[model samples]
Target: MKKLLSMLCALLTAIGLPGCDYVNVKELQPGVSTAVEVRQRFGPPQHEWRNEEGSVTWEYSRQPEGAECYMITIGRDQVLQSIEQVINEQTFARVERGMTPEQVRRMLGRPASSQYFQLKQETVWEWLMERGSTLNDPTYFTVSFNPEGRVVGTGRYTKLRP
Candidate 1:
């Protein structure tokens, strides 16, 4: 009976808090870890950037239904330089029209998901954030990028709940 009760409690907790999964920030060791290790642990990066100085940046994100989204900047030498969280209000405010995907990714990490419209020649990236009044319902911060990968516009939408 005790074992059954323990299992029931765990199941209830998991189902009740779907987005509260653990994201161990300490696992990322800047300046000591390699790009390959980062990829192996976190899976594929959702976005990547190559700077003029030859350094590269990779962003991995989990939002609305997950803990955090962060960026790991790797130098030209392939060593990790920085691990920064990019999921917050200040970051969202920085997104503006005409910004490059690289610039936006640096601020907001990877979006939760994206959609490409071939006929319109545009891509829409969406981030799910908890900014609405309801606790369970989240709002989406969307940025539309042109074919050239520049931000063309942005918008916000709230999820409807019954």
Candidate 2:
């Protein structure tokens, strides 16, 4: 029975079952959920950014395997301010040339993967995005930076999933 259960779990994962690492942020009310509660539910963040207003934005990246990256903000009072899913078309449009890699990371959270091209003197970061209305269509959004570490280009591509 234990072996059978393990097999079932593996099959579910292989078929891309939702909620594997999904967090229902709607249940976490802004201005109500404390920082401690946020940490309890999401565990430690991959990165934390301190804002000028004394707020901190925590990055929870579900990458490489999962398709969403969440940015949760905590006010100076230690209260939850907002929860945003940063991997989307709107955010992608915000990326522009001359922007630094840090700016990109802040806007989009951590990427699924990064690759450096030695000859081209460029670094490309990739993020897996939602299929949205399309079925079995795996999409990837990419940001490319030049040797100076400034945004040079952005692109998107889809690979059909079996």
Candidate 3:
């Protein structure tokens, strides 16, 4: 019985129970919706900034287990202009939600510009360049999916190379 208890404890710790609690509106892609629409969806973001000229910028972020993070940015017009999701090698290895983690890893490695799929969830994966960040960082591609197992969108953001 003691051995079983120890095993259970170890499993719980490894699984990262109470994982990520992330939900935001700016995650919505740009060129699709306006700022007023975004404000209505997420109900005033956690953080907002405005320039002297009245341009607006909103930022949303979630830190998943293993210190991984997902961030999205929206411009003044309420357009989703940027997104950043980072899963270090370790966090990448621990993803067991939504389609086997190995499958997710494979998709990330061999990206073909665009891939769409629908399963227990829908996912559209793509590669693009992100705004901000110097040329030192490698380009990052994002695979975004919708709830009902349908991939509604995909995008990529590459950092400029200096």
Report the lDDT tens digits of candidate 1 across residue range 14-79.
Answer: 454323223324555788888876664555666787778988877666664653677778898888
- Model 1: residues with Cα > 4 Å off, grouped in runs: 1-23, 63-67, 100-110, 113-124, 131-134, 144-155
Error of 1 at 149 (Å): 7.5
Query: To one decimal, what is the Cα RMSD in angstroms of model 2 from the true structure?
Result: 6.1
Cα lDDT of all candidates, in order? 0.71, 0.82, 0.43
| CA displacement after TM-score superposition, residue 16 of candidate 2 (Å) | 15
Clashing pairs in 2: none
Q: What is the Å distance of residue 63 in model 1 from its true position?
A: 5.2
lDDT per residue (tens digit) for residues 1-162 in model 2: 755644454454345443533434655689999998776566678899999999999998778667888899999999999999988889999999999999999999889899999998999999999644455577899999999999999998887755
Best by lDDT: 2
- Candidate 3 per-residue lDDT over residues 1-162, each given as its tens digit: 755644454354344331312323223456776665445433444445454655555533222112223333566555666544534444334333455323553323323244445563555544332323444544454555565543333334654565
Top candidate when judged by TM-score against the true structure? 2
TM-score of each: 0.60, 0.82, 0.27
Of models 2 and 3, which has the larger TM-score? 2
**What local lDDT does model 1 show for residue 58?**
78
lDDT, candidate 3, at 83: 43
TM-score: model 2 vs. ground truth: 0.82
